[model samples]
Target: MKRLLLLALMLAPVPLAAQDMASAPGGTLRFLDKVTGRVQDLSLSRGQSVALGRLTVQLDECRFPRDNPAADAQAHVTVVDTTATRPMFTGWMLASSPALSAMDHPRYDIWVLSCDSGFVAPEVTEPEEDPDAPLEEINEG
Candidate 1:
């Protein structure tokens, strides 16, 4: 039954990655969009509330490798705000990994703010008329 247990472990979902923020169950946090890797965190004035439209996210789940409990692999994260209606936007995100080496907490909700003059909302592109067109665009050419 060793094979059976191994199969069970392989099929199980990563439970740690599926947790939601508890303190503010439905609320969103505001902060600099450091998650997007474009805006600088220091530039964001703390304790300032700002309007928002889109959110970027990055998550890394912690896990251990077989035969090596000391060596663990942490989750990864990156979030983008395509619906950037406002030039800047930010919301709270959950922190998952504590005491890990990261710029921010694994599951802490931080505001993601983006500020750029050219960061205007783009018009939604329409699909082609071809009934048999591919599910996704293959070429913009």
Candidate 2:
């Protein structure tokens, strides 16, 4: 009887985090090319895909705290290696703690960066034009 109950539970369908996913207008992912030591950032919408190296990363959904986006962010993505016969990864990943649920690939590492409702520049900068700034003069000698 106990074995039967356990078997039933094991056979039952498991639900993904789709309901808990926070809806957003946009999503972004970052992938590290371990072989070349280069990082690539990809911006995508729901059901969008981007290719990095030999892997194709597809974003299913992205969400963030409505109150404070920076507080936390999560994304559902599917990663596939075009050269492989099976998928590399497919699941939800957190932005703050990527290592918690990360891809275990030898030459590729991918993670969620954020889920934005609209375009937000990742970096901010200001022009610098100090006339007194020091400049090194090259010596031909």
Candidate 3:
């Protein structure tokens, strides 16, 4: 009787606890060209797509932990080969672990870098030129 009860409990489905994630406006992705041994970082917003070499990468969404945004980042991406009719990869890619859900491409590799949330550019101010300063004449050869 005890064995039967234990077996029933073990067979019962257990629900997983979902983590609280916050959505970001955009995120950064890294692309690697295996042939040329070149790597580049691409910044893209949600629902944006960019062409790199023969592949087109589309960012569906980017999410991070609400409690600690920098702890981890996960981005839903869809990678399509321009020469192919169907998409090569479409799934969530984690920033901390790229190998977990990596795109299986021969020439190129794509992975999530970080999620950008409420990012603002710093203001640029030009230096004020002195009116009293004499300008030096340039000699054109």
Which candidate achieves the best lDDT against the true structure? 3
In order, the Cα lDDT scores of the candidates are 0.35, 0.85, 0.93
Q: Residues 1-141, candidate 2, lDDT per residue (tens digit)?
A: 999999999999999654343589668898888878998889998998887768899999888876565657899989999988988899999998999999999888999998975545478768787889888799998
Which parts of model 2 are misplaced by more than 4 Å? Answer: 1-21, 119-141
Clash totals, every prediction: 23, 0, 0
Name the 10 consecutive residues with the lowest summed lDDT in model 1. 20-29
Shift in Å, residue 80, candidate 3? 1.6
Error of 3 at 100 (Å): 2.0
Q: What is the lDDT of residue 114 in candidate 1?
A: 26
In model 2, which residue pairs have backbone atoms overlapping below 3 Å?
none
Which prediction has the highest TM-score against the true structure?
A: 3
Q: After superposition, how far is residue 83 of candidate 3 from its true place, in Å?
A: 0.8
RMSD each, Å: 17.9, 11.9, 11.4
| Model 1 per-residue lDDT tens digits across residues 1-141 | 999999999999877754221111111223444455443242222232233235444322222233332232232233445554432212322233323323344323343222211223568999658887666758977
Give stretches of model 1 more than 4 Å off: 1-53, 58-63, 68-73, 81-97, 103-141
**Which portions of model 3 miss their true places by more than 4 Å?**
7-16, 119-141
**Please, what are the lDDT tens digits per residue for candidate 3 over residues 13-65?**
99988889999999999999999999999999999999998899999999998
**Preferred candidate (TM-score higher): 1 or 3:** 3
How accurate locally is residue 59 in candidate 3, as Cα lDDT from 0 to 100?
Answer: 93
